[model samples]
Target: MCGIGGIISFTTDLGERHRTADEFAAALHDRGPESGGRWLGRHALLVFTRLAVIDPVGGGQPMVGRSGAAGGGRPEPAVLAYTGEIFNFTDLRDELTRRGHRFDTASDTEVVLRAYEEWGPACAERLRGMFAFAVWDAAAEQLHLIRDRFGIYPLHYTLTDEGFAFASEPKALFRAGQAQPVVDRDGLRELLGYTPTPGRTVFRDVREVIPGEIVTFGRNGLVRRRYWDLPAREHTDGLSETIATVREIVQDSVRRQVVSDVPLGVMLSGGLDSGIVSALADREVGAAAGGDRLRTFSMEYVYNLANFRSDEMHASPDSPHVATMVEHLGADHSELLVTTDDLMDPAEQLAVVDGMDRPIVGLETHVAFRRLASRMQPTATVALCGDGADELFGGYIWFQDPWYVQAATFPWIGPFHGMEMHSGLVDRQLYQELDVPGYIDQRYQEALAETPLTGEETAEDRRMREITYLNLTRYLRTVLDRRDRMGQAGPLEGRVPFVDHVLVEYVYNVPWAMKNLDGREKGLLRAAMGDLLPDSIVRRGKSPFPTAQDPAYRQSLRSRLQTISEDKSSGVAELLDVKRVEAVLSAPSQGLGAGVNRLSIEAALQLHYWTTECGVEFKL
Candidate 1:
């Protein structure tokens, strides 16, 4: 795992290339603190900071490699600035060796370089891991940017005066003066809309390399080609066969991902998804004698156990379920407790926003994960998470709710409509100008148009498929982005085995009935891995990542909002409706569980901090 950034200018000379690369590297220091390197060419400059996961000494970047076909009339060598692990590197390496490719290091980076040399951009199709990488093809004078199938690792790029620049995070581009931190009307709409627009970011002119895409920038400007996508296919396998295949693919993904040179562990959430991963990982690691016991980690609130409240989102505290799993697995486990004070700390809140590179409404979740990553960093350099399972297997409540499944908008947005009153607090005229509703409708239609279909499924099947696609392609991106930004900020590499494209592809075609076989969310997943987990965990309902339920947390938010409302010169003051803000601040405390109060307060506070701290220039 590492941080990669670079500039590619084909028409103009970059005199300050070294300085720009240095700034980019420095901005990404936390992501890769072990080592750093740069490769400069006439038209391209690549810089990378290393986390030293595999073959620490030898696996360095920007790694340069000569194309296997580099002779006669071929292009020059390709230089790769890459991040994320390639679970199938050893297998790909063996194939490459058989095809006469020589190896110099036991690193996936080299395998990726050689694979690109052999297969060109099509090599992205063969890779089966979470990654976002850049390959400056010296021969063709074209720069190729590729992200994994699920966008597990982030890569953002923007068109520059000279040519273009790309980085692991948008901050690097801003820090390098490649892109400005400006949010226009559309950007603000995106910020508040909660509907993800692929290839677009909250910063204008800055675009993300869409997941499962290869974007090439060269003499002709730029071209984007989808190297992989969820295919619409008919399922012919029986129930038992489907279950067996899922088990096999998931286990293989876990087995492959455990190939880490540094200390590794699982982010055991005591849910079906993470429990399955933890169990499978334990088996894989324990297979080798003298192998270190699998380490597990979970998060809890300081007073959650004593004052826990069941709401629509969470059924019970994770500690009890966590304890059950820990004892059942008999693995090394650690629980990190987060307090309302921690969630309300100005510095911690700002850090969460900074890590996300945007204003985050889920401040508690991000803060907890950020701290959890910090705690895990001391014992693990890499941790496997169960992120994509929900999207792939119909695990969220909206997936099972008919209201959401049949809704015209994104499924998750329906329930949140009543809960998300922050929009009402925005300046009325400014909110009208933003047209967040129209923007969301437009984005929803666009996503629906892109939904792949077989043209043979029943009406119900088609709707389910569309819902699944929206979850995977749109909603899941937010989840993965949070994991990547927070985990990498801790300098910990987070892997999601459930996101393996092979697994996602196969499970995506399964009918909705089978997916919700027992009329429960994630029923298919439960059937496949239930035996590995304690029966209680297997029977537990879907509980989203826990939030601070303490009433003090609500008081803290109200206090902060009051402070912001009184500060005349506050950056976000002009954007908010003061009367509305005061009303929210003065309203009786509803505790933090009410999505409306919590999310509204969080949005206002985050917007204030983001605008003030990040020096954001709003062009509305």
Candidate 2:
């Protein structure tokens, strides 16, 4: 795991290139703190920061490879600046060696470079891990950027007058002057609306390299080809057979991901998705002779344990379940209890906004993850997370609720909820111009049109398939991005085993009936791994990540929103509706958490800070 940035410009001066490269490296310093280097070509410059996970002594970048003299007219050279892990690099290296390729270092970086040489662009099909990489082929005078099948890792790039610049995060591009901190009307729609367009970012010109995609750029302009996508296939396996297949795929993914040189741990949320991962990891570690006990980490709000209340979103606090699992596995566990003050800290909130490079909702959760990553960094470099399972296996409550399921728009942003939370504080005229509702419906239809189907399913099955596709493609990307930014901010790599393409493809084809076997969310997963976990965990209802229920947290948001409303020169003041802001401030404390008012206040404050601190220019 590392941070990578590069520029492919034929017109920029050498001095300017050096300055940009330096800024890129500095911006990404936290992502790779161990070492850093730069590779300069006549028309390309690559900068890499190293985390040294696979082979501490030998693994480094940007790695360069040259073709053999035999059958090679003027030995071609290719340079690679890569991030994320290739869990199957050992197998690829063996195959490449059999094909007469030699290696100088025991690193996945070398295997990736050789794979590019041996298979060219087709090599992306063979890789089975989370990654985003850039390859500069001097011979072709082209740059190739590739992201993993599920986009567990992030890569952003922007087109420039001379050429283009790419990086693991958008701040690196902005710092290097490759892109500006600007948001247009459409970008605001994307932000204020809960729906996420696949390749679009909050920043104007910066865009993501969509998952399972390879983008190539050169003097002939740019070309994009999708190397993989969720396949539409008929389900032939019976219920029992499907369960076994899911177990096998998930276990193999966990086993492959646990092979890390640096210390590793699991993020145990005490929910079924994370519990299954922890159990499998424990079994894998115990199977190894003389292996130490597996390490697990979890977090909760400081006052949540005593004052927690049941709601539709959170069924129960995670502490008791976490204890049950830790005892069942006899694991070495660590838990952090975060205070309301910690969640409300101005400096901490600013750090998260800066780290994310956008005004993000759920400030508390992001802050909690950042704190958890910092706690784990001293002992582990890699942490397994259960992010994609909910999206893949239908674990969210909205998935099972009839109203949400039958809604015309994206289920998460059904007519009654979610969308209003983001737009409640914005100016009425501006909100009308943004037209978040229209944008949501438009994007929703676009996503539904892209939903793959076999055409032989019942009406219910077809609708379920569309819902699953929306969750995986749109909702899950936001979850994955949050994990990437927070974990990488701690310089920790968070791996999602459930997101393995083989597993996603297989389960995506499973009929909704089989997925909801017992009329429960994630019933398929529970059936597959239930025996491995305590019964309580297997039976626990679906609960989203815990949040602070303390009224003081809401009180803090009200105070901040009040201050912003009073200050006419505030960066986000013009964007907000003063009447709406005053309504929130003057509302009774007891009425704060009712509906989505609390969420709206949080969003407004985050936007204010992001605009002020990042110098974001609004083009509305």
Candidate 3:
């Protein structure tokens, strides 16, 4: 909802800390354009740019409150800075008010400050929305930072001698100089591993607060604690109950997220996730005054011939699936199409690299959305995304492995060994020096080992926890980061209804048999929406976010790779085997082994870009 940044120097004065906080806030100015404020206290100072979501008249942040134990009034107040929307504030506010909590504003930010005042750290459990917040407890001289249970919002922090500095984005923290500019090589390896975990950012020193986790930095030193976890449970609800509950939760989630001062829209892929979100937005906005009918956008390509050149051409047939629901919703719709040339812009690629703070996969569409969002920014400040459905519903192709999908393990947390050929593209010694393979293997093992697998259960059951965990901890976070960076970069707010912590918990606890009853993934969600969406739209199979198929995009990548190889001054030149790289891209991609071309070339290209642009030094 807004951008928050601050610095806490254990041994510094107000003047120095205020200066640093200003820079941090300035770095995030685009995230919150309505208003900006700074709160200077005894030990720490906070600054926030306000988007004016809840209380346009009074809801400016860096909200301060006196700390108290439960109902008792305190001598001093805690200074709080937050960046997110708390959807359940009306309910929380009423309850707190009954409990004798008074408020000065009709804003969720104030409600959150009061909630923390009334319940201490336990306040997070009572919250039900997407948020990442930092509370500077001046009395306790501790900085308490918390991220939502699903990590739908971001909070990156770095520990410094001055104290702990945190912000809504990595760029802000980078500006604060609390963290080094060096890219996190290990994280790059993990991304190459195809699992960019949410908790780790590209900067080694800048770490994101993991979902459901809290960190308190005080004189006792920094302590990280888990405030929540999705406990595995057996689903006892009837089929109908499970279906109805999912529908209700999703509907409620979408309705709550639509509450922004500015107009909002939906990203409709005509897929079930976006379909459901669009339907909910369509219904909600109608009942609310001064709101616009939901605007939806889907990407397409000229001629449909763009497929042959798609940088990530999948032999398994797929297409942009959007028309069904867009027509049904009867909402304002725009299908933005681009040529291979549109996506091949080196400048756009560089912008994406800079936007994400690292070279990334799926940049083509992310960049596309950035452009699309820019066009929509004149009409809307926020857009709802259907990002978490696939991970939560066991919708990946690999999940088709009955054992893997159901085996009480994480479904999307696997070693996509397709990067081996790309590893060959690099000098064997330099590749080993990067220790890319070992680094990637470590992340996967850590992910799998974190899940408790019982041999007795079906593969779906065993992998349930792991898959859901990966969705929440890794994939979902990446999507959130992408949506947040892209949307905010265009000065638009991005909301993910599927990442609702309450719904995530509910889905994770649903019995595997119920989740994919009769061998259909996401069967529960489909049944839940029974009549809300047209049967055709609800029944459509899952398709990942749309990507370009333009042959020029592939050619562009090839050209970029060639340029990287020929540019002897490029840092990546030392690590790459020019001959092997040429052979891979020059040949037909069909003969590449399972998961080979997509994974390897992507990694090789990402690595080359990182070394040349991201300033990532290849150790080897």
Better of 1 and 3 by lDDT: 1
**Residue 500 shift from truth in candidate 3, angstroms:** 1.7
Q: Compared with the true structure, what per-residue lDDT tens digits does model 2 show for residues 1-620?
A: 68999989767644346787899999998789899888987789899998888988888889888855421222668889998899999999999888888888998888998899888878999999999999998888899999998788889999987789999999999898888989999899999877668888988999999999999989888899999989999999999999999999999999998888889899999989999988888877742324798899999997899999998788899999999989988888999889999998898888888888886768899999989998997778889988899999999877899988998988876634653776778888998887888998899999999999999999999999999999999989879878888886567889999998899999999999999989999999999989998999999998988888998998898888888877777789888876677677775642344344666777888888888887888988
Question: Against the true structure, what is every candidate's RMSD?
Answer: 2.0, 1.8, 3.6
- How does candidate 2 fare on TM-score? 0.97
Tens-digit lDDT string for candidate 3 (421-473): 34546565655666875776667678776653434557547666666666667
TM-score between model 3 and native? 0.89
As a whole number from 0 to 100, the lDDT of residue 505 in candidate 3 is 73
Instruction: List where candidate 1 sits over 4 angstroms from the true fold.
Output: 67-75, 287-290, 421-424, 589-596
Off by over 4 Å in 3: 16-18, 66-72, 184-188, 287-292, 303-321, 402-417, 420-425, 452-460, 584-620
Query: Cα deviation in Å at residue 107, candidate 2?
Result: 1.3
TM-score on alpha carbons, each prediction? 0.97, 0.97, 0.89
Better of 2 and 3 by TM-score: 2
How many residue pairs clash in all the candidates, one count each?
Answer: 2, 0, 22
